[model samples]
Target: MATTVRRAVLTLPAAPLGPENPLPPLAAPGDVHRPAVPRARDGEELPPAMARRMTWAPLRSLLPVRRRDAYGRHRQRTDLDALVVENDRLRATVLPGLGGRVHSLFHKPSGRELLYSNPVFQPAGFALNGAWFSGGIEWNIGATGHTTLSVAPLHAARVPAPDGGEMLRLWEWERLRDLPFQVDLWLPDGSDFLYVGVRVRNPHHHTAPVYWWSNTAVPEAPGSRVLAPATGAFHFGYERALRRVPVPVWDGADRTYPLNGQRPADYFYDLPDGERRWIASLDAHGHGLAQTSTDLLTGRKLFLWGSGPSGRRWQEWLTEPGTGGYAEIQAGLAPTQLEHVPLHPGGEFAWLEAYGPLAADPARVHGEDWAAACAEAAGRLEAALPRATVDAAYAAWRPYADHEPKETLAAGSGWGALEVERGRLELPGTPFAEGTLGEEQRPWRELLRHGVLREEGPEPGPSLVSAPWRELLESAGPGPYTAYHLGVAQWHAGDRSQAVRSWEQALRYGCAWPALRCLGAADRLDGHPERAADRYAAAVAEARHARVAHPTATALAREAVEALLEAGRAEEADALLAGVHPTARSHGRFRLLRARVLLARGDAAAARAVFDEGFDVDDLREGERALEDVWFAVAERLVAGDGPVTEEVRDRARAEHPLPVRYDFRMGA
Candidate 1:
């Protein structure tokens, strides 16, 4: 019954995570929720402390957007590399190549899968950079959205555990925050619980905003209740507001059951200062999973996709149509996902989390009294796995945190190796060796070592915008290539004027259409939509004339059409879209754009027909309502005659043209 760690392969039907978008993510996709709460709402307001530390603004920068939208919906049987850590009582399956996600945790005695084990490896548009799938225990770091490493590989290795058994260690330098982090997972020789040790290190000389959330997905079932040690919670819904509401029941429904509401929502439980932080999801039979962590991880949240059509549709879209729904019970360093904790210079945050089964009294867990229900689950959790044991585990794991990895298991991005080489980082156990550096880091290495950025290909492969990289780019002499990168760095640093100047200079120096597209993004951000459209159109024309790759041409055309439509030039948008490659025309994104143009040009029938044709944007983002909005907009135009469509017309359109399930990917109420 000894613990063992070994490498294995998981063959699932997986959609290939296509190449990263070559374009610099000059503009954020603008999908994050920055909820603005009202001062007066029946004596409800965000706690003053929560409101003050809510944003990581002035420090948060998303400069190098490595777009992962190139993945298509076609999933083939694929062999995913994995690492398995198992003991007598439980087995943990980790996907080393996929952000070090814990793909499955199986309890041997009960023959139960504690985590929501996704049946397939489908990449959806959920991550901050794109391409995210539902289910599993996902480690989210680097700002408010899903981590940029959602589907990216992480360096995995075998390390010695405190228990004398080998532990699986996963480490990577988070690009967004420019910090190194590691996760060590081990199961003791004779334990039902799987232990995880997480550490995020800010090796920089200045303060860095650090966000970490261990998101666990559990199967959603009838009578399932999420129990936490808090009565009141901060509720955030699609209305884009955070309101303090009572737990268990709010807005005349018992929301802890996951299926009680008709919309997707988050309940960030307000845990007491000294309370043992833990959360559990118990099913109808009173048997379920519980997660507990050291005091360093304070936040607990319940994210549910309720029984509404939109929520159901989103659930189906994330996986197969007939799969059971799941809800996320998460723990983070901050009280809510909206906040980011500041890790001081040369500081680190570490914690230990344990996951296993808990069998509680069903009647008490489902009772009317919220306190009694929580106490019931909490008591059972304590009896099963005491808080002191978790603390001791953390203490034991800390010393081994710096132990050199015994054997390499997988490879991650070489950005860390590049950073380590540039900065002379002395990290011990989590090494970013020079051998990990690849083609992506070549130009940066050249700039770092030789002081000049070399032109790699037709387009710049990626972007680096952190202050250090910016300093390096700034030091690199002024050329078309250097200027383009400097523009991106300047833009991320909030130097809009200088960024624009640099981009313009790059274009003048014969830089490719990337500069023009970046300029287009800047114009849109500066509130000149028409100017943005012009820049985008110009970029598209230049790309075609230059005989750029068909994908690049299509990408440029997509941006142009979007900007043109946003500028209220539907005819121009349609004309521009029509001239793109046939693959672009058939793309789900373009089809939706065409529908928008048809509605704008006063052709509701044509717009509706596009919906009937049925297309899927493989990378349709989480919480994106563009498709649903357009469908209803076209419906309103079809139902309402001439003048402005009033509320009455809107209601009629909703009733008459109910959103088709195929297109209902709305994440809100």
Candidate 2:
């Protein structure tokens, strides 16, 4: 019933960037050569401020774009390599051109993808800093959550295996955490499994927090549930609530399905004990895919959003959600998702996880037999683990000698959701829920990165960051990034004139249009539309050469277009739109701009036509249709207006998009 795949390493053209791939790079082009993470020598400690910030789960917060320290992937499609390696049973397409992510994994026997194959390698609103894409196994390193370089290109090669098969290998040096990470994936000539090996190094003198998870994607249907050897699970909610629940079945519903009506997204921190190493997802027919490991250290997790309107929107935004939206069957280094995995200076952590197919009667699924089947498959994969990674995992596990085999775990016993209190045990609430998110508690990186930078802005709040971060930004010389950050801090500290001067200094240091963009914003806020228009025009020209693959192009274009229109330069706005990449044009923000430009030109019919063509918000939680509805509401109301359209448009914009929301919580960006 499946196509017979050929075992060949065919180098293909670059994967085409789609509508979802429209993020402007946070940094300038040709930045792949930026300095690597400082090799942490033995005894070298991370700055206390940065060390304290490492434990934070990175949040997708909106912050001022500080791109000088950023690295951008700027090579056009022609400059990259796309390699496809396949055997009779499996096939994988690796895009060395794009962060070396395995673009697709197919099961030839069933002709189905065992991993979530994203239709578009697009950038969207994810990550605490920079951009993020969904699908495949994105390697997250550095200060946990989304690594800065996760979406950027890395060093990659295609090497022939001894058996005449091929392997695609990738490695990158993470600058923020001062570490290096490598991944090697292979599909054996005659095997049904895809083998993967990952190695991460601290290479520093002091202990540093490390968080790495291979986020494997799979199709999610009504009955699709992740099957792993666990009786209990920890869940992180969309609102950031932590819940400990019985696995498979929680409360009265099957926890595997997207049936948690109140919860929009479900993140299960699997309770993998020492022995169980395989996790699979069973569909309504009890057949899907599974990934396994021989080592006890590779923990499993199941993360999917609700099947509500909002969740459906995300599916369409990130990939083709309607055909069969995807979910994640993630594997991590430890039992808890929030645990700060530490790597000693010069320490390296290596492990392996294998992928294979699964088929069984639905009766066996939802029953104890499913667990047995998983264990059997896991046993079969023991031979597949690379000897080196297996040895390393064993060496790493031996020190934690007290862990019992997962087979002995029970729903009501062990570390089963016992919320750890101050040396006390209470299962009711998380430390975050208890209003006591101490400095000692893991900081959400979103807060850690800019919580302090945003402090002295427009509002008053007790300082969450009582540190010298400000001093460093101000006194760290006039490097472009430092100057930019210093500007932000000064602006937030209520010194607008000084912020302008610092931003000008950043421009002199080659920071380019981000400096201009900030300057334009300050000019506009100070009631100088002409000055703002001048800066926006310069930014528009600086962004001209940026194409679809350039990360900064779309964002810079958007800001410039809006500022041009606001400055009564509608024709100039229209002309400037020509330079924006077509991928960004597919977004609602760009569509809105086009419509506004038309309306300004008195071409009412054309504006309405453009609005009806399908406006879309790029955020995952809302699809194109939501923007269509907002457009209809605005357009219909304006047909009878004699004056300009109402301010309700911006309010409606807030409802339909994430960008309108303040960068900070409940306040300003």
Candidate 3:
């Protein structure tokens, strides 16, 4: 451990640049529920029990916050409280006041910034939630996009290191998720690499999907090139469609070249199947960043807005024009945000990623060349320090996590400790004017156009059919995601047979689990329960075969069990539910299906027990809650022989739990 020197606050002459555009104040992020308003069944509004299930969204304040003033300026300015740390080989600056982001990372040896440092603190309304700021490796955890705490302050400490090195730790208790995360960024004395270790803990007895992607932004200019270890990848597009393409070579154009044309594309590509790690970008002179984790499981993602007019408009929209647009080299834990791994109750997730600068002559030009470079690069990094020194440094790391720490920022202020701490930096957030609503259109459109699963709805277009166009989308080498949407377009056009055929082709092209799940939903909606069950089963199989089981896959398995129960096939339902993970088995839907199965087998007492016992309904949405209530009500009526579920019982249950037509991840599903 390094000695703790006398702490001194220094006033700097120059300030970091502020965002060109301030984030518009956000209203709490929640689904835009198009609820079929509660109808009056009786003269007395169904006597409360028949009332509709509520749309109780979690408090929005808990998500990442970007308070806006009357002119839409981000309340927390980026110029102040800019904490700086450095070593012999590298230097890092942290903006504690600006969401605690590592604002800049410069390699002293190469005099190059390994990470992009936006001159302006620009935030985009692009997150799955509402607020997102670009630049640096922003820690995105909780749901898929930006975390609630992304913009808020994180409790920060510049921990002392005995060896004259720097170890600054940032920790926070995520209020909405009931989880705590700690990120320790260590720059050892004389070391070339910056070590980032993140630990997330879920202490609740309920399971939920946890998301994280270390978003690294690097300068994308005329001389830059990308390198990853894969031949081909699953490319997710700007229109929220999918396709498979050879890595760094899409439409036969080498994507590694920074100038890959102006027909803008946005995609998250899955690298080749094997034990691989590292995703890098280097300029023509071979100077940039190479990042990797302790484990080899990482996805290489590229976000390139075309050089075209609309694309440039978006580039400036996100930041500012003339500042020059940059591309993203994201290292993710999952292929797509839709298929994140589920974190079990009381489970812990930990990972270590290293960001180091690299330079090579004639630099890597393709995926194959890059993979070879990574192997040598990894060895060189490991050889930087003694084995014991590296091992002891990490092993001695202590954790600081709290879910209910003492509140600061003055009583009733509602700002968190980090926010208060951020205030100490001198740049303060301005309060919004009364009745001011956050600008949500940009975020909503961003999701609709680029996001999968959690978007608002299908991109607006004719919901009717065009046979000739359908054949073209299906046959013109469209990616799986593109094909799936094509099938959807066909289905809306009154071509069910063609839709199925189109979807199956994408399934065969390695679209994996999502395709099968989509088919299952369609079949079930079409009243083909047995066929849907088959599709769900196949989808579940694919999910299980992945390095880790996916959330939607298990959710689909629970759905399949429901289908079997609906078909009065108790044994089939029982067998399938048995194979699901315990956490999934505890889902309210699965338990209700089990209860239904028991009732079908004449086990009234057992069925009642399933309902009487507590159901883990903590993380479920309105629909799931409604389904649970309805099932329990039905079961109670059947068990008590209460004269065919009287209108009173039906009304009460329906009122308590009015499920949407479908409860799923899909927009509007």
Q: What tens-digit string does per-residue lDDT give for candidate 1 at 1-669?
A: 656899899999888787777677776555445565433145565666666667455233455657787888778999989999999999999998899999999999999999999998888888888889888999999888689899999999999999999899999999888999999999988888999999999989999888899999999988999999998888887767777888878889998999997899889999999999999999998889999999999999999999998898888877887899999999999898888788999999999999999999999999998899999999999998899999998999999999999899999989999989988999988999899999888988999989998875567678888888899888887789899999999998889999999999999988868899999988987899999998998888878777877667777787788899889999999899889778758879888988999998999999899989889877788778888789889989988867689999999999999987788777775
Task: Write model 3 residue lDDT over 596-642, tens digit each, in one string.
Answer: 77777667667767756745332232112344454555545553463
lDDT values, one for every candidate: 0.87, 0.54, 0.53
Candidate 3 whole-model C-alpha lDDT, 0 to 1? 0.53
Worst 10 residues of 1 by lDDT: 32-41
TM-scores for every predicted model: 0.96, 0.58, 0.50
* Pairs in clash, predicted candidate 1: none
Task: Tell me the TM-score of model 1.
Answer: 0.96
Candidate 2, 139-164: lDDT as tens digits: 66654355555456565544444244
Compare candidates 1 and 2 on lDDT and give the better one: 1
Task: Evaluate model 2: give its lDDT.
Answer: 0.54
What's the residue-level lDDT of 497 in candidate 3? 83
- The C-alpha RMSD in Å for every predicted model, in order, reads 1.9, 15.1, 25.4
Off by over 4 Å in 1: 29-31, 38-45, 58-61, 640-648
